[model samples]
Target: MATTPVTQGSTDRRRFRVTGGRQTSPQQPALSRWELQALLLILALAAVLYAWGIGHAGVHPYYGAVVRSMAANWHAFFFGGLDPSGWITLDKIPGALWPQALSVKLFGPYDWAAALPQALEGILAVWLLHRIVRAWAGPLAGLLAALVLTLTPITVALNRHTIPDTLLVLLLVLAAGSLQKAVGSGKLLPLLACGAWVGLAFQAKMLQAWLVLPVFAAVYQLAAPGSRLDRAWRLLAAGATALLVSCSWLLVVWATPPESRPYIDGTTNNNPFTLAFGYNGLSRFGDDPHALGAVAGTTASRTSGNTGWTMLVNDIVGPQISWLLPLTVLALVLGLLWRAGQPRTDGRRAGFLLWGGWLAVHVVVFSTSNGNHGYYTAVLAPALAALTGGGAALFWAEYRAGGKRRRALPAAIGLTALWAVVIDGPHGRFAPWLLPVVLMLGLCGTAGLWSSGPRTTPRALHSALAAGMASVLLAPAVWAASCLDSRYAGSPMSPLAGPVGPGYREMRHHGTKPRPHALNTPSVRDAALLNYLTAHRSGEKYLLATQAAYGAEPLLRATSQPVLVMGGFTGLTPYPAAHHLNTLVSAHELRYVLLTTRRPSTSAVFWVKQNCTRVPPRAYGRIADGSFTLYDCAPGV
Candidate 1:
């Protein structure tokens, strides 16, 4: 080998040359062995959190319906058992069903089988998030981020359920992380992977996936200095890949015969392709503004139009979860300040800004839209976690630079741990005692700033402090897990002993009743109905129809039946009569109708009750001590 000693600094900023055969600066310490072990522990905890109440929780009803529906109808929509019917009928995308269907096929229609994948995915998402943040910001930031997400109340709740939200969260994190990598390296493969992740996200929840990419691209553009054309080309490629991946299902559906379409409601346009792309795609932004008023029982005529910005904000952000408002505002201010102070060479600062910006965009867009759901706010967890991590990192770094820096770190850690104990400790249930702990954490951060010593003290102290804060944040989560165990240990109603105010008491009463209660025991009734349909049905080739859209999951579970609701898309609700049911009933296409008392007014039940002779309610077995009723719609007589 010819020996040419390498220089320490190369003229080319982009290129790296080994100096005297030494590695170009030791690899940055992303995760120490201890940090790795801690992360694995956190991941294990997340898995347990997601898996503990999988089958026993009331959340299973909705997922059960999805599994049962897919098992029964996969052939009808895809293989031609029910001619003209497709695989899914909900207003949502078909991406969520594939996992559920696979679960049913492998695990034999078990609710846990359908739910376990989501739990595992949720854990994977948390782990991946930790890895991404740790790589960029160091293990401390990564640990804080992971802990925040692990303890998030809504994140924990969504992970245990079978809905698409958790899956979407996982996909979004993966896409964002891939985009972060692609932006750094400008490699085509990472960008393509980013596109594929976004496509999966879209498959999970439709166009919400697209909303995240622009935010990521803008961050990349600002962080990386490149020709405008180059950036544009990369974005275009990524977009094309995303579209290709996301539209694969739509393409399959489009190529199939009209009779082979598995879903109802949104499936029947003069041009199914146009309807799928445009109406289902863009119409949601317009339709969601009216959903709240519609939910509140206001007529479309009486409600403000979808374009009204104020009403949109009120509907989506204000009522969804009021706790998020202050935290979001604080995070934005802190994120901007953090970005402004950082040196340009510190890529981690840019990553923080980008993640924070992505979070802000989610809040802003969702807030301005007409569509609102409490769970939709779950997307903000990563941003909040990052912001909290950043704040804590800054505080800890400052604390580590002082003469009393050694003491500072321990003091901060001790104070934080004490706060967690006082506020969230089992004995601290009295509301009056909670204020001092909050005041102490705030004072500790404020006091660190006024200290004459170096800034490192505050950063190290806050890092330790952040971990303690995460413990406090997670106390409710620990309690919730214990409550779930208690619920499963005896009766589902046993967990209700602690909270019994008017609202919950009413819910308990209604949940115990035979009729459908949307809030509490909807899942129980749904599961029972699914079981009843499955035991009574003879053929693997039966078509199941539901007037109630939300009830589709339970129904699906009971019979391993395919449903007629809109495939999980945005505007598949109030399922149209002249278009959806009239065609199916008149053609005598469906074998059975699983009617529930919980049907929304726009459901097929209302229409069937009005048009067809009411069939007698057949006794479906009870679940959670509540009864489910099944009805058979006679062939067109």
Candidate 2:
């Protein structure tokens, strides 16, 4: 039997003809007028959503400071230093920050410069998704998927900031596309390329990128043209490739001598594996004594709501990424059932399984895991978009065939509308009119589909189908547009979309407050403190010592000078023990210290308060708010 071969040219060239009992490829043809138009429109939409007003989008200062440091010095750049002087490395891997650091170097460390990479990656991700979906299903399906991903509120929000998730999503999408190609062509190269992509994605997100491994192997095993044993061995090869690529940079860091490089933050022994697996990995789910917040005795849950099966549908996350989830689920089930009789290499069924499995694994992991931020849902956008678009195409093809499948489109539309209303909740505070409009469009489409009999024209059917999809998409699009508003632009650390949740409320309130050390400038109070420290400076190696990155970040951002963070990000990680700090002070290598006034101070903080002279608030132009105390460790004092 002649099969359709995946091709880079027009859809016309994808068909193969059997001539003289042999398969022959068709001549390459140009894209149809509609395909070109849709492709351009999708690209345009992505550009606008990700690039418009990106200059003003806020950045994560902690990362921003690190980017600046990396740009200023190659040593810091290689190690992901937290300050220009390379006193300590960032808590997380610096793979995602390399592009931003290079951008800052080229463009002079502007906020937009750091953000440009994410925006470009986001737009590229959109285009890549379109190409992948178009190759598997059709141009229409691919265009729909691209549109859905572009309008995903969380996707839009994260792309506007300098977050790692942007790169992670792009690489994962690349992996999925490569996996599809490997399945279509039955080649080892594309399979290995899939693993390579996942490995690179792992650099952006440590263990989270590995979540799709099972899905990839399962899809390829079921759909790729190979014996089960051969496929299993091929999968092992790919996994090895992934592990090697993931550890490429890690090995470099580990091999560097301790004295030659900055100490790895978030680890007691300065080990990268401990930081990656213990601090960033398993510690996220279970309790850890060393976690900064946990050690500080804070009771806050890291997630937006309580962890459970219903976590995704809760008010906080539902508005961000769950708008079309129900429709996607329905489409997946119906599509799988519709294609049940197809051969094992069936592209449509393979697509449903691949994307559906991606969604399932993430849902399970996030539902049960702790320390999950809502924006972490950004990774799910591509899978959801692909499934929704592919499902739409599946149902529409069946509907056009004039059979029981005709009910699938109308049912999906109605169910999506109801789900949208539920996600909007009782108040519908963010966009009250959206739910009603969705219902109205859904009703119109369902009524038209239900009433149109065999007499219905192709044009009429197309219009009804368009209305049905528009109903399901309306809520997410509007919610995504909310991020365009300055009030809803999101915070640097935690990006959220829509105005319906506690996270949004908190972010909105905090988004407007000025950072003490924004960009290269410091606030007036901090400027005064910096002047006092600089004026009283001896030949100390560091300007002063502070509790953690919180105090060090602003000082480093304001001036590219070295500021010692006694502890790491949370002031709980054991770095620079009390004795070491005392030695520094006694040796006059550090003359001043700034400790938080919060109770239960770390041993280092307690030591500073006991051994160093308490600088008068008036001396540093501070009002003694009891929040922070500046200590002077002058040698003769």
Candidate 3:
């Protein structure tokens, strides 16, 4: 086959042949033996990173409760309800948890079962990223991307938990792959499929998934084999399909009468659109006063610190996701600059822009958002991995040609190592020897790359390249491994990895496990309360009522019996109004209410205190510090 050379080096010349507008690399064999081995090795690493010791992993109690409920009750499953009785919906959409719920149904709701889907999704994401990068660059680049993604600290941490973001990342990566296919084939079907994938991702995460729409549109419009007008119209059609798919569940809930379905959390009017666009979407950027205020006042939000350009590299987020930011940014800039003279539809440039845009959009959004958790940055892993792998491949090929870009490879290695050491500085007490090893590898690799040329032995060149890659990746690998430590077990909600605080260090020093988060591991007092309520229950529709999901989550996880969350996640959702509570009490459908002792009570608490008798802590086999008041709401109590 007559081929067009894509790379300049005669020693390792790679050629691309375009046929029927699809770009195919003639030099790279399909699934060569070495490639297959590397692929399998990377997958094995991902499996170990995401699935090891998951049986003992802690579950996020809020989502865990929903998964158990959804597994048992189709009503709760369809609505993504927080309780078995489907009384109230969770704050976020339910699609991401669907896989975990199904896993629970098949495997009996064990922690491993709930966590199994994300681990598998994470592995699939790695494989998909490899395929896409390999198609654009070569097998070596693909394998490196897969390996980088596999070892991303936040990706490892998120996949080990039952959280929405894991599924979101998987779906978004799938969407990227589909968009790549569309770019290659210039077909309507692939574009539509890409839209459908993003729409499905929207279900996993409301508006966050749509962040890549601009990237997808730009890449396809700039790279696809069609007139600009044709591509523009096709994109419109795809956008319509995405909107329809994204609104699929919302329409169902809207059609269901208020009395027939659970109350939608995080919205005043119970409208699904309001919840999606207002509470989960615009509020993330501080557009809605109430939602933003509630989010800002949260304990997790308070811990996230202020938002700014430096947030991603700050103490809270750097170790989890920023380990590769320097390398990734340099790769994007240099790769695009080198490819500037290529045609608009150049596949290599398209790959750089696609992944680079993905990383850039997320950086701006996450860095400037009102509040976000460390695990939220897991979405950036695939992009960073792609840029690193593809850029390294481009830089190596250029370096071998004795060109001006030869310094790019060594500079990337040096910068990556320097950033790794800087990030590792604060955590030096935890891994003192790590920085020295990383520095040595980086220095040696940079020197080797700087000196070697076409005259260098193949073995020496490969060794130098391997050392450089290792220097860039070692710290992230270590940080990712820290997720499996017992001292980090309590953070399923946040899903943070590494030495989070002095508490983690203290636990590590003592060789002890930290206490479980309050929302997951119920206290002995909670056990006593559960026992007391169960003993006195009399055909009540609800076992008891509590102020918010936090108070009710552990109970829901412990049993299938329904517990009403009076105010949703925060004690301010105004769900179960006092009149509703009075109605339930008068009808003998709710006989108990649990209220915290904090002053300035909500209306539900006020009603319970006025009409219901307070049960002494002595009745439940404990002395009270006035932290909580359990009320007997039975009629005429």
Report the C-alpha displacement of residue 238, candidate 1, in angstroms.
1.2
Model 3: lDDT of residue 199 = 95
State the lDDT of candidate 2 residue by residue for 1-637, as single tens digits: 1134233223422333333322333332355898788878877887887778877766787888788888888999999988776878888889999999899889885778888999999999999998787776665677889999999988998998888999999999999999988877677899999999999998898889999999999998897776788788988999999998988878889999989988888787788777667677766666774543222212221343535798778877787898888779998898788667766776667888999999999999988886477788999999999988777776666666666766887888888888987788754766778888999999988788777887889799778877888898888888788877755656677677767544456645775432322566677888899999999896888899888776777677667677787777767667778998989887878998888744346788878878889889989888874678888887668
Q: Model 1: residues >4 Å from true position, as ranges?
A: 1-30, 60-63, 72-88, 267-281, 287-346, 402-555, 561-637
**Alpha-carbon local distance difference test for all models:** 0.53, 0.78, 0.81
lDDT tens digits, residue span 184-238, model 1: 5556678789889999888877777777877777765655334567767877888
Q: Which of the numbered candidates is closest to the native, going by highest lDDT?
A: 3
Name the better of 1 and 2 by TM-score.
2
Q: Give the TM-score of candidate 3.
A: 0.94
TM-score of each: 0.70, 0.91, 0.94
Alpha carbon lDDT at 435, candidate 2: 80
Which has the greatest TM-score? 3
